[model samples]
Target chain A: MTKFNFELTKEIELLRLVTVGSVDDGKSTLIGRLLVDTKGAFEDQLMAVRKKKGTVKVSSAAEIDLAMLTDGLSAEREQGITIDVAYRYFATPKRKFIMADCPGHEQYTRNMVTGSSTANAAIILIDARHGVLAQTKRHTHILGLLGIPHLIVAVNKMDLVDHDQATYEKIREEMKEYCAKQGVRDLICIPMSALTGDMVSVRGDNMDWYKGDTLLETLESMSVLDDLDEKPFRMPVQLLNRPQTADLPDYRGFMGTIASGTVKVGDELVVKPSGKISTVKEIVTFDGNLQEAFAPQSITIILNDEIDISRGDMLMHVGQEDSDSKFLTANVCWIGDEPLETRKKYLIKHAASEVKAMVSEVNFKTDIHTLAQDEADELAMNEIGRVTFKLQQPLNYDKYADNRTTGSFIVIDSFTNNTVGAGMIV
Target chain B: MSEHKLTQLKALEAESIHIIREVVAEFRNPVMLYSVGKDSSVLVHLARKAFYPAPFPFSLLHVDTGYKFKEMYDFRDAFCEEIGADLIVRKNEDAINKGMNPKEFGVARCCQALKTTGLLDALEEGGYDAAFGGARRDEEHSRAKERVFSMRDEFGQWDPKNQRPELWNIYNGRIHDGESVRVFPISNWTEMDIWSYIREEKIEIVPLYFAKERPMIERGNMLIPYYEENKDQLLEGEVPKMIMSRFRTLGCSPCTGAVRSDATNMDEIVIEAAAARRSERETRIIDHGSNSMEDKKKEGYF
Candidate 1:
């Protein structure tokens, strides 16, 4: 279809997602095909893809090379793999989508973590012939650790298996059993071919045996995001906006995005680490003072009384229980070349605060393929292990499952200033 | 600025404002790159809103190419004056002394000598630890993978292959002494989103965006405005005609191209953009080379 009159409002829902799989699992092709068939691509973009040189052909149509879609995804061919998470956007009348095309190589686990942190759902592509490969299990484990709300197992290359129902069932049952063991609660499995455009953007007639919805239909129907107001109030102050302007001579507003839950006027909250109590006086913005503000919305908070607080301090509900901790045992995915050795100091960046931290012990490393826990003394590059950290000071945080934003932190090498690892508090 | 459920546009506005505040809080010497374009205008407005009642905490750096349209300079002057922002216009004095122009030295060398070198010179003189850029991912191909807080090395080289990873909304703004981070808060917004937000917010833009009758010449599918400053370049057979035209994107006057459109306002531009088949960079002369922007960016061209 050529361009026609299309005017849209910003009121539509947006679904943020991440796509992960092993190398050559047709992840790029799947996204490319999905966007192309749904008319998400512009004419010039399609032309550029078609004219792309030195493409490895994966399409039978012979006109456009689908794999070439990964070219500009990062344009950084680091050892022939994507180096960063490339965010792609597409919209339907039903909803808007923002997806991160995460790399699959083992060493780039940090890239995968970055993509999944903000995502509500994950599309894990699994080759039908190679059911539940080691990389597939690794990605699933990472997804589970990140507390992603929904998961979709795209059993690709159904055409290669002649769209066999029994084959799909076997793979689905195996994955379900594994996920159950890994504590993954929500999942949906579908069989399709990204190369042949089956059950991706449209339902193929050959896959009539599978009665489930198409991938797009599933995404459109699922409420992938959580209502932030239902949880406890948490907003780490990014900065203080004391415009101190002419209209209001004395004005002090704490600027931040509510990590979860809501804050209303006169709500009782405590400043973390400082432990000072205050009532929310106003929710300030450029337009006007808001009656209430919730998660993901950036606004300024004004308290009734002057409290001693700064950017690093967090504002949280007083009712949240027993959150102070000096020692953290978290699941960490090491992303640096330097091995994570015990007693080595690193900076823990949590929310807006940073603390001096050192690994106390390496409990065990999970062999992602076998789902076996093996004792390890240290974690090298691309290794995932349960590690204990002793912080120089107490940190107020919730379990990763409770709130994705407040429960996670990053490990920065103190000397190199490199992000070496990503940890989710257990 | 409407107070309601977080709409897409409102979300974008909040995100941009947050980034600006982060720059102010974290960096000692920070500056906003104001190119006198729509994106930079939106960026400066956000900066003002981000620090309401107080003046902008940091100064603004405009790497004046001197080849820019006259209207852009006027808009830059008035906008900065109205907002009371500290605006510093840095021009490459060496190139001006050497009499460098597109007609003499071609688009690449001229842009390099004027914009790239001029921006570096400004940063060196100002010692800015952080610079806020209005680059959107949907605007260019390679920018799709850029971090919200992208880092440039001590020599101002962008290592696209070996860069830091950005996770969640939490950006790593940490850097060394010589290193600097280029933060893009509106990285998620698309071209249509920009125009639509402009209409909703009633943002005042340059008059060159509106179609008007002006003396113009066609050069290889692009319409070039014939300025009085360049009257000497007209050939004996070349007679410029007054045509209705407007620019989808603005840049150096000689390199920027205008389109044949009757879109005279934000609403009309939005409507025209909905049906237009051309990419935004099609009119840019520097990008005519084989994907040259990415290569230039790696060498510290923003």
Candidate 2:
């Protein structure tokens, strides 16, 4: 057995992204091609796919059936479509990538929501000949609703359109107008053929009219390392640690993952939903005590005063407005097959807090294809609608558009406990 | 020892810790299925970090297949004592007394009884609503799209297709009376990630991973550990001998095979794994036939 050099050739920041597009738009093909071009797949992995039993290879040459590289399950292979959100990982010299490959079937749109929810950016693919379809609009709207910081429109299959610049430009203009209306601030449009391997990893000299960065370049250079530390401090306490002993009986600390901003030893703190005030005395990890902590860092913090805090309680800076509300309106994507109805009590899990909330009114549902709002009594599976909630207890949360951490929630069925719907505070 | 900016490693660690904490906070009764392997070691380490200066809210449960290496048991017992963790060892004493061994009962049936049923029996007694396992996606074909919060039915069955959509960091740990959810905090971590993390954290692992001279017998191309219990159960032409080998994955002793390597330390093992082309599961003897991990997991085998 030859020793494979598993060394990191270069230091690369990991970027998590999701690609959403309609069926046959070459999303999986492009992802496979990226791994192949970047040497992400091991030789054994490639060979295993090539020698897969009962699976046909699309190309005769040294090419692989790219779709087979990702649709791993036997059921998915038999059905010829992706069922769940399959996460694929690869790294380039510029950066490492965690790509969530979502299925494009309309019924599987719940999966798209699951995939795109935590993505730092998204690549919405488009068929060059088909132009801007309704599914494209639906995906674009979902990405915006997820508050994904960046967006890339990969206009795939230019080879089918004879690599024409006019068609690419037309789609670009249409997408720009549509995205502006959808509130996508950072958008990049790239036209390439995932099948021909042109401009995916290697910048093939095709369609010279497009002088912008390739999809790979755009993703690598995209500003995903946002200065979250500068934002107001917010950490939802998930666990409370108390080493209750004879010597250290009062040693109590609030443990949580810092969702945003930074904290120092002397900074004042505010426990949400209670407005109890305290000051940071120490930040603790298993390593040792710390003087300061920042977003995404898991730490146990000891405050100057003992505030009545428990699991699902959020701690934040006292003055961070736009991070609190009880009666809130939100855009909900009904993921469960069971239709959502007004006056239905569901468990709304927002950040670390879970509260029993009921939908007071089902405002209206959107026709994703026509971008029209229609009056509806309830939201079914894969349907998006606006609704108002009446919470049993007052909960402090940031708007979904402002802070992705506190602004989003999932509606769990009280009777079944299945996550029935995804909500983004409007 | 100090707060730092978000590196990729720190981010992954925080995410895993967050998941572990959520399970402990949300579930009515949660138990961690400790396998005493590298990934499980990382999970325990994360749990310790998640609740520092305080005792763990949950207990560690081990499903004893009665076929594991002697060194694995030693490591588990000592580690539990060292950490002062409440450890529960659930064994299928009925199946063992009924003469259910891999040599006689065959591989699949033996595993189903000893491993899957062992876990089921433990869960039944504990009434745990959630169980944490150190399963990773990069380890197998079926785990490519597995959710971090994987749901199990009343019969402890996993429906790969019909799973709840886990969005954001909010996990729906809410389950019915008999249903449970298997939480994989380190689901996204690859084998490479596991080894790298172990090296970074200086976590303790079992000595079975390091190659050493041990009594062994080759059966079905697997280097089985030649124990006193299996002295008379050798196949027709198979004889026990001392062989220098190591296990890539630790399972029931009869089912898991040893790989010929000289990685006596974490550094050497990391280098070998990186260069060894074949995935780690290649060393798993039980995974050879129709008994895949996915199917075993559906039957409640961690």
TM-score (C-alpha, index-matched) for candidate 1: 0.93
lDDT by residue (B188-293, candidate 2, tens digit) is: 7867667767877889999898899988887765677888876776778987888889888888776777877888888788777655545677667666577777
lDDT of 1 by residue, B1-302 (tens): 23435776777787787777777878889988988888887787778778765667888899998889999989889988887889998999999899999888888888888988888888989999898888887666677777888899987778876678666766777898899988887888777777877787778788898889878987656798998779887767777889899998899998898999988877788888755655777778887665377777887888
DockQ of 2: 0.52
Once superposed on the true structure, which residue ranges of model 2 sit more than 4 Å away at CA?
A: A1-11, A51-63, A204-214, A321-323, A370-377, B1-4, B212-245
Candidate 2 achieves a global lDDT of: 0.82
List candidate 1 segments past 4 Å from native.
A1-8, A51-62, A73-79, A243-249, B1-5, B232-239
Compute DockQ for each candidate against the true complex: 0.49, 0.52
- Kindly list the per-residue Cα lDDT of model 1 for residues A1-426, writing each as its tens digit: 344343446556678889999887889889888777655566555666774455544233235667675565335554577877887877776677888888888777778887888788999998888888878888898898888889999999899999999989998998999899889988999999988888987797899989999999998899844666678888888887775678867878788877888788989999998889989888877777889888777788889999878987889878774377889989998888799999999999888788999999999998987778899889998788999999998888888878778888989898888888888889
The CA lDDT of each predicted structure is 0.82, 0.82
What is the docking quality class of candidate 2?
medium
